[model samples]
Target: MTKLTGRLDDDRRTLVLTRQFDVPAEQLWTDFTDPDRLERWFGAWTGDPASGQVMLTMNAEAESVPAVPCRILHCDRPRRLSVTVTDSFGTWQLAIGFDEDEGSTRLTLRHEEVDLQTVPEVGPGWEWYLDRLTAAVAGEAPPTLEDFVDTYAPMGQDYAVMISGS
Candidate 1:
């Protein structure tokens, strides 16, 4: 996976991460959009996720957003999926994609349009979550973001503050 700190869609403020996955497109898509499939490897969703469905309050624990609610923007089986969210940081797109690769599929997922200035919490976050994703798909243990905010977010804040100070 190639992770770069830069703009997406030519927007200088947006950050894009392009990554490749080794699984078939269908499997990856199911794992991404299906709440049940996600719960199998990730956290337990308080409810199911379907296109146009309004997320329930219980889903706050496991959902498209951990810190806040978000809307499911697009879901195209085995190819593309995206979500739209607005936080204290800013508005942005989170997306997943898959392509045919010698019978398997090449996957690229991104957390795009993030405000690096406001949401300083997302830099090390992508690296940390992507690492968990690799482990999750491989049937291994992955740490929960909710479980690690105290551990990683503070460190992230300090690191960003340091970078900005310099």
Candidate 2:
């Protein structure tokens, strides 16, 4: 498994997360865009994945949150995707960029226009979910939310401090 870390770009109000996968860019893109494939890792989504609104029900065993409504902003197959997500907390933008090197794929997930105060929670959540994606891609069972949260909770403090410069 690869180390999960995110770069905080205060100036841009973005949290940039990166991951390198042994699979091709197209495979990674399918994991994200195809609802069936997405359900294997990330939340299950309904509606047109290419363009338009979608509803996502996050798959979790404990502390499950409500389904979020998202609007697809851009979709350039196997390359880039942008969406606006809205939930009880608020609305935010998420962008994913994929680059292929040889047969491997590098994914850059950017959470844009974010409220820095939420870093402690959001950072760890993304880390766990992304790791689940990695596991799914590797044909392994996804970890339960309890396990993921327990393992990643401590890292939230590190991310908070990094983003706060304190």
Highest lDDT scorer: 2
Collision pairs in model 1: none
**Relative to the true structure, how large is the alpha-carbon lDDT of every model?**
0.57, 0.84
TM-score for model 2? 0.91
Which candidate should be chosen as best, given TM-score against the real structure?
2
What would the per-residue lDDT of candidate 2 be over residues 1-166, giving only the tens digit for each residue? 3244987875748988988999999999999888889989877888776558889877663768788888999989889999998988889899999999999999999999878888888888788888889889999988776666578777888887877687
At residue 28, candidate 1 shows an lDDT of 75
The weakest ten consecutive residues by lDDT in model 2 span 1-10
Give the poorly placed runs of model 2, Cα more than 4 Å off.
Answer: 1-4, 10-12, 61-64
Judged by whole-model lDDT over C-alpha atoms, candidate 1 comes out at 0.57
lDDT of 1 by residue, 1-166 (tens): 2233322345544445454567778877777666666655443334335645333222222445444455778877778877765555565677877886865776665667555564456655655565566677788776565634645455465546633654
